[model samples]
Target: MQYIRNFCIIAHIDHGKSTLADRLLERTQTIHSRDRKNQLLDDMELERERGITIKSHAIQMEYKYKGVSYILNLIDTPGHVDFSYEVSRSIYACEGALLVVDAVKSIQAQTVSNLFLAIDRNLTIIPILNKIDLPVANKEKVTYEIMYLIGCTSEEVIYSSAKEGRGIDKILEAIICKIHPPKGNLKAPLQALIFDSFYNTFRGVEAYFKVINGQIRKGDKIKFMSSGKMYTAEEIGNLRLKHISKSIIRSGDVGYIISGIKDTLSIKVGDSFTSVNRPAKAIIAGFKKVNPMVFAGLYPEKTEDYDNLRVSIEKLHLNDASLTFFPESSIFLGSGFRCGFLGMLHLEIIQERLEREYGISVITTIPNVSYKVFLKCSPTDIFLVDNPSDMPDIFNIERLEEPYIKASIITQVNYVGAIMSLCIKKRGMIKNQYYLMPQRVELIFEMPLSEIIFNFYDRLKTISKGYASFDYSPLDYRFSDIVLVKILINHQLVDALSTLEHRSNAFYIGKKMCKKLQKIIPRQQFDISIQATIENKIIARETIKAVRKDVTAKCYGGDISRKRKLLLKQKKGKKKCSLLVK
Candidate 1:
C-alpha cells in the first residue's frame, strides 16, 4: 500500500489529457512499443472517431523510478460538461489528480469546473502545462493563470508537451513523490466502492471498484449496500491495459470482481460492496447517480422496429445508467420511447450509437427541458412537465417556471461584444465578468437552459471563431412569462413540434418555425396549412400549395359545356379534400 499511487487525469475537452495518459503509459512500459496507438485510454471506436472521452478507463502500471518500484493506478476521465458526474465519481475513487491545461489556451471553463470538483473532494491536485511544443505556447502567462487559479508556485507547476514526450519522466517522478499513497484498513471488514460497471455476455456483470477498508479474494461472498444482493466472487483482476487475473486484491487497490451476476439492473455505479459474512458497520460514501437534464422522444422510422429499439435502449442503458427512457406515443410518428440524457452531446451520441451500433434508425423530436407550472385556482398546487404536449390548459395555469443554468464562457476579449449580443437575444442576464488577463476574459451569465439547449453553443463557437469554451451547471427553476407554442398542420396539432417559448417573442418564433416547416413538409394533392398557435389562437401560418393538374387545359378550344363540367368536378373534389382535412 505504501508504494501504491491512485490518481486520475482531469481537464477540459481537447486539452491533451488522453495524450498525457498515453505518454505516461509509454514511459511506464505498460504497453509495448509494437502495440502503441493514439489515445490508448479511449478504447471505444466512437471515442476515437469523435476525439473525446465518453467513458473513464483505468489501468495499473508498474513503474521503476530511482531504483524503487511503484504501483501507479491511473484513471482517464471524460472532459465534457455532460459527463461531469463521471468526472466527479472518478475523482472520488482516487487520492490525487493531474490538472492538465493547454499552454496556448490557458484555462477553459471545464478545466475550472473540474478543478473545483477535485478541491471539493479534498484531493491533491498537481498542475501541469501541456502542449509546450506548439509555437503559440506562452508558458509565462499560462503559469500565472495556473498559479492564480490553484494558488501554486512556479516551481511546483510542471511543463510538458505530451505530443513530443517531453517532461514525461518529470510527471512520473512528481506522482511518485508528491501524491500520497491511498490510506485504508487492511484488516477491517471488507468495504469497497463500485465506481463503474459494465455488462459482459460471457462473464455477466463486471464491477470495477476501489477497495477502501479490507481485502477481497476469490470465493468471497459480497453484498451490494444498495441492492443487498449476495454473490460469490468468481474472479478478481486488475487492469494492465487488459484484465489480468489476481488471487487477492488488498486495500487501497483498484480491481474488478466477476460474480456471475447476469442481471444488469442489479449492478449500479456508485454502489458500495461489503462482505456478506462479516459486513462492514458503515457503507463507504459514494457519489450521486447522474440525473438527466435534457429529454427527447425517439421513434423508430418503421413501426415494426419498435421492439428492436426497445431492446437496443435496454442494452445501451446497461453500460450507461445516466440514460433514462419510458414509453411514449405520438400520433404522427407512432409509439416510441421518451428518453432523457445529461445534455445535448449525450443525446446525440446515444442516437448515433443506436443507428450505428444497434442498426436501428430512429427519428428524434426537438429536445426540451422540464418546466414547473403553478395553478391559478389552487395557489399552492404545482406540476412538473417534461413534454409540452403534457402541459395543462393555459386558463388553469397561473405562472410557469423554466430551468435556468449558470454558464461560464472563457474566450478572447475581442469576441465579448458579439457574445453579449447573442446572449441578450436569448434572454440571458450577465451575472459577472472577470478579466483573466489583458486579452482573455471570463463571462458568467444566468440563462434559461432551454435557450442554450438549442443553437447557443454552435452560435457562440461561430461568433468566437471557435476560440470560446463553455461550461454550465443547473440552477433553480425561475418564474417566467413562457407559453407552449403548438404547431398545427391543416388544423391538427402535431405534438412532436410543440415547444415552450417566451410569450413576447412567440409571434416571431412562430413565424420562423412555420416558414421552415413549410419548406420541409411535402406538398399533398390538396393545400396543407402550417399554423403556429398558442392556446388555440393562431400566431403565424404558412401554406404549401397543392399540386394542381389543369383538368380543362386539354379542352382549350372545346365547348363551354365541357369546361364547366371539368370545373364542377374539380370544385367537388376540392370540397371533399377540405372536409377530410377538417
Candidate 2:
C-alpha cells in the first residue's frame, strides 16, 4: 500500500489532458506498441469523431523507483463542464490529481471548476504546464496563472510538452515522492467502493472498485451493501490496458471484479462491495446523488418499437449512470421517455448513441428544465413538472419556480460587452465580474437553466469567436412568472410543440414558433391554421393555403349555366370546410 499511488488528470476541454495521459502510458510502458493510438483512453467511436472524452477511464501501471516496484492507478477524466460529475467521481477515488493547463490558452473556466473539486476533496495537486513546445506557447504566463490559482511556488510548477513527451520522468518521480499511498487494513471485513461500471454481453456487469479495508478474491461470495444481492466473484484482476486476471485483489489497491449479475439495474455506481461471510457494518459516505439540469423527451420513431427503445436505454444506462429517465406520453409524439441530462451535449450524445450504437430510431423533443408548482388546493405540496404539457391549469396554480444556475464565463476583455448582451437577451442577470489577467476577464451571471440549455453555448462561442469558456453550477430555484405556450394545427393541439417560457418572452417566441412551423409543415387539401395559444387565448396565428382544385377548368366550352352551377357548388364546399374548422 505504501508503494501504490492513485491519481487523475483534469483540465479544461482541449487543454492537453488526454495527451498527457498518452505520454504517461508511454513513459511507464503500461500500454503496448500495437495498442498505442491517439486519445487511447477514449475508446468510443463518438468520442474519437468529436475529439472529446465523454467518460472517465482507469488503468493500472507498474513503475520501478530506486529498485522498488510501485503500483500506480491513473484515471483520465473528461474536461467538459457537462461531464463534471465524472470528474467529481474520479477525484473521490484518487489520492492526487495532475492539473494540466495549455501553455497557449492558459487557465479557462473548466480548469478552475475542476481545481475546486479536487481541493474540496483534499487531494494532492500537481500543476503541469503542457503544450510548451508550440511556437505560440506562453509558458511563463501560464505558469504564473497556475501559481495564482493553486498558491504554489514557481519551482513547484512543471513545464512540459505532452504531445512531445517531455518531462514524463519528472512527473513519475514527483508522484512517488509527493503523493501519499492508500491506507487500509487487509485483515478487516472486506469493504470495496465501486466507482465505475459497464455492462457486458457474456461476463455480465464489470465493476471497477477500490478495496478500502480487506481483501477480495476470486470465488469469494460478494454482495452489494445497498442492494443486498450476493454473487460469487467469477473474475478479479488489475485494470491494465488489457485485462490481467488474478486470484486476489488486496486492500489499498485498485482493481476490477466480475460477478454473474446480469441485470443492468442491479449494480449501482458508488455502491460498496463487502464479503458475504464478513460483511461491513455500514456503507461508504461522500457519494452525492446526480442532479440533472436539462429535461427532454425521447420517443421512438415508430410507436410499436417503444419496448425495444426501453430495453436499449436500460442497457445504456448501466454504462452512463448520470442519465435519468422516466416514462412519459404526448398527444403529438405518442409514448416516450422524459429524460434528464447534465446539459445539451450530454443529451445529444445519448440521442446519437441510441441511433448509432443501439440501432434505436428516436425522436427527440425540445429540451427544458424542471419546475416546482404550488397549487391552490395543495399549497404546501410541491408538484414537479418537466414537460410543458404537464403544467397544471392556470386557475389551479398558486406559485411557480424554475431552476437557475450560477454561470461563470471566461473570455477576452474586448468581447465582454457582446457576451453580456447575449446573456441578458436570454434573461440572465449579471452578478460579478473580475479580471483574471490584463486581457482576460471572468464574468458571473445568475440565469435560468432553461435559457442556456438550448443555444447559449453556441451563441456565446460565436460572439466571442470561440475564445470564451463557460461553466455553471446549480443555484436554488427562484420565483418565476412563466406561461405554457401550446401550438395547434387546424384546431388540434400538438403537445410535442408546446413549451414553457417566461411571460416576458412568451409572445415573441410564440409568434416565432408559428412562423417557423409554417415553412416546415406541408400543405394539405384544407388550409392549415397554425396557432399559438396561452391559457385558451390565441396569441399568434399563421395560415398555410390549401392546394385548391379548379372545378370549372374543363368546362371552358360548356354553357354559362353549367359553369355557374360548378362555381356555386365549389362555394358551398368552402363554407362547409369553414364550418368544420369552427
lDDT of 1 by residue, 1-582 (tens): 999999999999999999999999999999999889999988888999999999889999999988989999999999998888778888988999999999988899999999999999889999999999999999999999999999999999999999999999999999999989999999999999988887777988888999999899888999998888889999999988889999899999999999998776787888899998889988776477676799899999999999989978876776777888999998899999999998999999899989988899999998988889998999798888887889889999999998999999999999999999999889899999999889889999999888888788999999999889999988899999998899998888999999888888789889999999999988877889999998889999999998787999989586799989998999889879878878
Candidate 1 local Cα displacement, residue 405, angstroms: 1.3
lDDT of model 2 at residue 186? 88
* TM-score, one value per model: 0.96, 0.96
Q: Model 2 scores what on Cα lDDT?
A: 0.90
- Clashing residue pairs found in predicted model 2: none
User: On a 0 to 100 scale, what is the lDDT of residue 370 in model 2?
Assistant: 92
Residue 230 of model 1 has an lDDT of: 89
Q: How many collisions per candidate? A: 0, 0
Q: Candidate 2: where is the Cα deviation over 4 Å?
A: 550-552, 555-582
Worst 10 residues of 1 by lDDT: 283-292
